[model samples]
Target: MKQDVDSAKAVMRELFAPTPLQHNLFLSDKYGARIFLKREDLSPVRSYKIRGAFNFFRKALAADDPAERFVCASAGNHAQGFAFVCRHFKKPGVVFMPVTTPPQKIDKTKAFGGDFIDVRLHGDIFDECYAAAKAHSKETGALMVPPFDHPDIIEGQATVAAEILDQLPGDANPDLFIIPVGGGGLSAGMTGYLGGRIGNESFVFCEPEGAPSLKESLTAGKRIKLDQVDNFVDGAAVAEIGSRNFDALKSFAADQVMLIAENAVCVTISELLNVEGVVLEPAGALAIAALEEMDRQSIAGKTVIVIVSGGNFDFERLPDVKERAMRHSGLKKYFILRMAQRPGALRDFLNMLGPEDDIARFEYLKKSARNFGSVLIGIETKRPENFDALTGAFDDAGLRYEDITDNEVLASLII
Candidate 1:
């Protein structure tokens, strides 16, 4: 960090204004502690990824031939980031993305790059797309801008930490700094900058439960590659911690990193939007959700800073986010009920529901049975407790039902 971070910070002044580090009154009051959010969600690319991408462009052009084109592989945030950087530098860019990537992201990437980039949608996953980008770079002699794995990228991300140190209201420091981890670029950069300045224990790294690459890698004392990753939290759903990022973060104990459930993150997103009017992508909610897992009394009066990583939310996914939030809150449920084939069977089932319960979906999945029919039902309620009452009523009525709310197989089929 010896003047390197400061230099990065100075260079970034040529970029967009530093993203705000604002005190959140709602979160602070609830946590009974001072809470600040590094609003990287407000960045030009709506994510901190742009810092790394831009820095890669900055240093690469200075050190190598400025005429060398830039190439990168990403399906979402990084793609937009690289696209923006290519335009900023007026350099020709070649981006490779997964064919399965949503059109919303593809359009955004195209919009950001405009005349500066050529986008290729190839492969189905990131690794395959990355390989294709590399091949393109090799064939075209373009300089590849890695998303998170290089020294310049890490240095670029470290600028966020430098800004935080400067932006804090006073000559004060946060007792805890919570950061969301994916490829670990931001975590490594921030931790690297802060550890020597503040201390290692002050940092908390959060990763998605479905893709705990950083935590798993730290626990195993090596880079651990996950075979399968739930890409629901796409912004932070990396299957492996970046090698260079891991090197920067490996000094900390495994417990320093926390795994956040994907659904719990959705709950945080919904709460932030409904209560604070803050819209966040799933990864952006990770640091805030991690608060729920912390020892309340331990953090009661401490000052904390959470990096709200990105707000590049696609409104198209609002339904899915709301669904996950409802499931996490226990206010919505799905069940398969065994109903008698008699005339009043449907009426009796409806009668068992509480006044606050409303059936959202009801269909007979199996009607071939003579005595009973397999009915799939989705219910929503005003409060989570209403479900308890409804279940008790069903039990008393001798109704047989299988709660499929948490059943992944059933949820995939019906929810």
Candidate 2:
């Protein structure tokens, strides 16, 4: 396995340089640990997916005819990587993406593959798109490249660990490694190599909270498929762990994996962007978010490594990211209020708010009767405690309101 990874690394160097490993000062002081980040976000395709795609294509070509066509299904990083691989080898390839996939990703994939690829917008989500791609592959006799779940893909991704060991300074083995899991190719590959080289060094896996497939599967002693998955963390939102990946990872206990909330991940992305001028997609910041959830005392003096998975973030989504971060930090909230229909009702409510509080949204939902009206309001404040005072003032003024911040159903419908 190690030799195969070394050979993959050699092939990678012929195409692009290995990503950098650098120490993070801000995170180190916050946790009192030496933290390093393996910046796979800096790869030519802005993700580690290209490594797997290129390896699969190379190996497949070597085993057959170079004239064979390739096909894959993805709506995120994998699509772009596969497209770039097709361009690199000058082979014709077909990429299937969800019809609802963002235009930015679609454009980038088209830009990467240029004339070497054909893209089709199928179903509404990845599973549907994947099914369609499989059907197409069968009909046309084109080779199907899975996102993860194959031995070749795992071997290709192991090159990341090989590079990390080669890139680190002399005798500076990290005591802990924080890796992010999506389809599990990257984590599976790295864990296999590091288990032998570092022998018993601590490893922590990070996943989107809404889709804890790997964690649940490990706990159940077998593969477990999630009935529903939240797609907010698009890159890391997978319904099930790949069989091959689970085999490589099954040795670890369930507690070793940590789930990060979608909103909290948004906070990490915002902080890294505002503080360090570093832009990371949600899945890319998973390893960093895990740092905040760790038992800090246990890692006080140890060396830590976090993998930054990708940076292909769309700037157009910045406003939504900021909103999620604010909500997670308790700096913003939404409410439903019953107020008198008179003109002075809004003014009275405004006067009850604390000095630091500002109204971010105010909309008249409807009038329940001739005298009372329903209103949707969003507020922003400097601190969470200000809300305690503001709500107190609301009670003192006899204002009727419901805090809908944590009510997902109500919030989803109105906010």
Best-matching candidate per TM-score: 1
lDDT of 1 by residue, 186-267 (tens): 9888888877677888989998999999888988999999999999888899998899999998998899989998999999
Clashes of each: 0, 0
Error of 1 at 367 (Å): 2.2
User: Estimated TM-score per prediction?
Assistant: 0.98, 0.96
How does candidate 1 score on lDDT? Answer: 0.90
Q: Which residue ranges in model 2 land beyond 4 Å of their true spot? A: 64-67, 199-201
Which residue runs of candidate 1 sit more than 4 Å off their true CA positions? Answer: none
Clashing pairs in 1: none
| Steric clash pairs (candidate 2) | none
lDDT score at residue 385, model 1, on the 0-100 scale: 95
RMSD in angstroms, all models? 1.2, 1.5
Write model 2 residue lDDT over 1-415, tens digit each, in one string. Answer: 8888899899888779999998889999999998989999999899999999999989998884653898999998999999999999999999999999899999999999999989999998788999999999999999999998998899888888899888888867688889899889998999987777665448889999999999999999999999999887888999999999999999998999999999999999999999999999999988899898888998998889899999999999899899989998999989889999888887888888888999999988995568998889999999988889988998898889999988889878888
